[model samples]
Target: MDISINYTRGQDDPKSGPVKVGWVVSDVEAPVIYDPPRRVNSRDARREHGKSASRCPAVLGLESRYFEIACPFDINIGFDRDKDGRPHLRNLAGTSGPIRASTLGKRLSITNEAEWRYPDRPIIQLKLPYIFLADEPTYITQLDAYLHYRKTPLPGTIFGGRFPINLWPRPLMWAFEWHDVSKPITLRRGDPLFYCQFEFDNPERSVQLIEASMTPELKSYLEHISSAVNYVNQTFSLFDAAKRVRPQTLITPARS
Candidate 1:
């Protein structure tokens, strides 16, 4: 089955825009490295196999479908002292044009920052060129900063949201924690700042919390292995008695 998200371009958006919304090519340049060179030595067969073994199947599953959202403009963000001597965030400069950064109660707003503006918070908003419309429910999440962009850590935490196509009409906000009062950071144009993966929601199923009763056998087992040291020594020892019978396999499985 073919699945797709519909996008409506903003009236003022350029035809040759640098930022992309949905699926994108892997070769695009970004500040972060998502998939690093797994193989260290191409000639060493053992080392090459070891690297392949270390890859996480879950990461590989979503890698190709992950949507990378890039920075629309070149901008600098820095810290400065307010009137009360407390630290605050300020927008230094932007290459694309004048960017506005303002505070909306507890949350900081970045406005004129993008092509499309939100109705409520016009002061600080990301103007996404395309308003994403899906046939079903979808989710958008930020890329892992520690894993991908370790050198240039995001000053704030990334926020994710679940959107139901028919009910939710507004685009997602590019929210961050914005509490780091340390050094300044710069995001160049076309920098891969955000990443998102989508899933189709099942309306038939609703989330619910239910109390679970433990079985007598499970309770007895838990009571018997309550001691941390004893449990580790008996069952989770680094050198186990089972290993003596048949050594664990360290080799990577050969590709089929």
Candidate 2:
């Protein structure tokens, strides 16, 4: 099943072709360390170490993919201290070098091409190369932004929330909020700040939850599991015990 994503390029969009947007799995390189190290000599620790060494296929299974939205240009977001003593957040971008609020009205003709104002909050806005338009029966929600996983520290925090998308006539713009209004937040060009996840939402589909008693096969399996001294050893050693099931022959089907 293929879902199409249509978009319109902004007039000041520097890129020549359509924006490259696709599915991406969570960055597994971003390690999740457990608090209070597991006991080195414990049975649980040994099991965990074995799983970790094997690359834990069950844990690495992909249930969902994040949509990466990159920043088009270098933008400096901060309050205009030169203008007034009062704090006011603003976004400025330049054509050549690093963009700042002081250099807004100086060199570049600041056009509203690669940016748009939110209907509710005029102060908070987003900059992008193009506007997306999708008529499919799909829903998109904001996932954790990529800034969280970046090694470099951000000057300011990114603000985002969940929003459903359908066959809306207007284009979809990335939402942003500057946590530090007094200080400047510079997001370099091609930096991925917006992360989202998409799911098919069929209105016609009905879902219901139900519970049932275990079958005889399931009961027998549970009895065997209860009798086992080590669960992992019993489960994973099946191929070696019977010589029938091969790990190399096991295949998991691709999800849409």
Candidate 3:
């Protein structure tokens, strides 16, 4: 989709004229390197693969607050949809744009994914805004996971076939096991996703949230977040740390 917008420097005013903006994305820049794939058969392959994939651009800097809106035209400052209309929000597919709406905000949409192989994928119009914490803590989690795998790689597992998917599927089984380590949490299909605004004055403070949809590509980011969560959980086991290791009484020490 051809995305055209009129952006202002500080705040948007529809009555105002055109706004100037510039965007930077992967396709336009050289690919970033974080981790690399390892041989699948190695004892440490599992951890290695995890680390490698986590390093992929699709994985890094995965956290950000995106907003969504309906209209792509002039953003209405004070106007809001009727309570009955069920207005929503989301982000442009590859690059981060503010909230996009169905009938308002920056007019944007996604065309065929293949189209932007060179320049980079186009943006998907969003209807709401949301907050994603892609900060130092998350980055450290990824680094620790990568180091662990580099030190001790393990065999990786893969499953292939077709199965029925429900709102909630097997609590056990490979899928659940795999996800349990790094389960992906998502907003329901109909739920409105939003962009998060942070206050520099009070970094701890939360900002307003706009509504939108969760695109598939954005889902990739959620998956990365899942892996980050898993790495952190596995690397830092407070429960395990609290307990001291005790040798078994049955095993006698053999000393000269």
For model 3, state the Cα shift of residue 51 in Å: 59
lDDT: which candidate is best?
Answer: 1
Q: Cα lDDT of all candidates, in order? A: 0.39, 0.37, 0.23
Cα error, residue 86 of model 2, in Å, equals 6.0
Q: Pick by TM-score: which candidate is best?
A: 1
TM-score, each model?
0.42, 0.40, 0.16
Write one digit per residue (lDDT tens) for candidate 1, span 66-168: 5555565555776565697544456766443444453211223443324223332222333342223222234434443333454666555555555332222
| Tens digits of lDDT, candidate 2, 1-256 | 7796444445575332322222211112211210111111112323446556334544322211444555545666555534544334555444445545454333212223224243222234553322222223345555446423555455444455543222211122355444444455666655665665554533222211111223343233333433333455444344243222212211122243
Tens-digit lDDT track of model 3 for 1-256: 9696533333353223221111111121111321111211223333446457544544333322222211112221211124774222232221332323533333223323354333332322222221222111111010111222223221222122121111101111111011121222222222212211222222322222212223343333333333343356442342233112211111111232
How are the candidates ranked when ordered by TM-score, highest leading? 1, 2, 3
